[model samples]
Target: MTAQTGYQDHKTDRLARLRRVESQVRGVTRMAAEDRQYIDVLTQINAATHTVQEVALGLPDDHT
Candidate 1:
């Protein structure tokens, strides 16, 4: 079985994602200073992008 609520449920998830993105940015900065692998940094960035997209899609439409 599956269950769902509307935008209310999404709010927490979105905030959590934003926090993760913030952390990732910090990590990337550290990685750059340490001269980490390019592919590793790219993967982290890609994950952050997907998280943003998911949050955007979960938002409710004002017109609806």
Candidate 2:
């Protein structure tokens, strides 16, 4: 089989996850602008935090 070129699935998946994290960050910014409920904002922040941590942990040690 011919060797693959360019970005591979492993790298692509990591990038896709990071993109979602970026969206979550943008949502947090919007919440601040709209003066959302304190608890509401915190809840979203907590969810985003876990998403980031999961992505970080999922990456191979050598990559990190």
Candidate 3:
């Protein structure tokens, strides 16, 4: 594929990952609002954190 095509595809993938992270945050918010168990909410928060970190870490590699 062409360079621009590859970049567009990667950008699309990154956007999708970010959207998933957004949904994860929303879920966490809902859980907190509903007074979910502390451990459960904490677990989801950790998951969201990890997902965002993964996306961030991939950014440098994408530039390379």
Candidate 4:
């Protein structure tokens, strides 16, 4: 793909990943409010972070 196309695709992917991350964060908040285990909540947060990182790493640097 051309640089422009690549960047556009990257932006779309990043936005989608961010939406999922947002939901995961909300889930974590609800879990906390419900007195869920700290470790479990942290695990979910970690997983979300990892997923975001993977998506970011897969994107081309020029896309940023």
For lDDT, the strongest prediction is: 3
Stretches off by above 4 angstroms in model 4 are 1-6, 59-64
Per-model TM-score, in order, reads 0.71, 0.73, 0.81, 0.69
Q: How well is each residue in 1-64 modelled by candidate 1, as lDDT tens digits?
A: 7755466645677789889988888888888889999999898888878877877776765124
Q: Report the lDDT tens digits of candidate 2 across residue range 4-64.
A: 6334547777787788889988999999999999999898898889888877777655254
**Count of residue pairs whose backbone atoms collide, per candidate:** 0, 0, 0, 0
Off by over 4 Å in 1: 1-9, 61-63
Prediction 4 TM-score vs. true = 0.69
Candidate 3 lDDT over 35-64, as tens digits, reads: 999999999889888988987888777666
lDDT of 2 at 49: 90
Q: Write down the lDDT of every candidate, Cα atoms only.
A: 0.78, 0.80, 0.84, 0.82
**Residue 28 shift from truth in candidate 2, angstroms:** 0.5
Instruction: Give the number of colliding residue pairs in candidate 4.
Output: 0
Give the residue spans of candidate 3 off by over 4 A.
1-9
Error of 3 at 36 (Å): 0.3
lDDT per residue as tens, model 4, 1-64? 6435565646777788888998999999999999999999999999789878877787767455
Q: Higher-TM-score candidate among 3 and 4?
A: 3
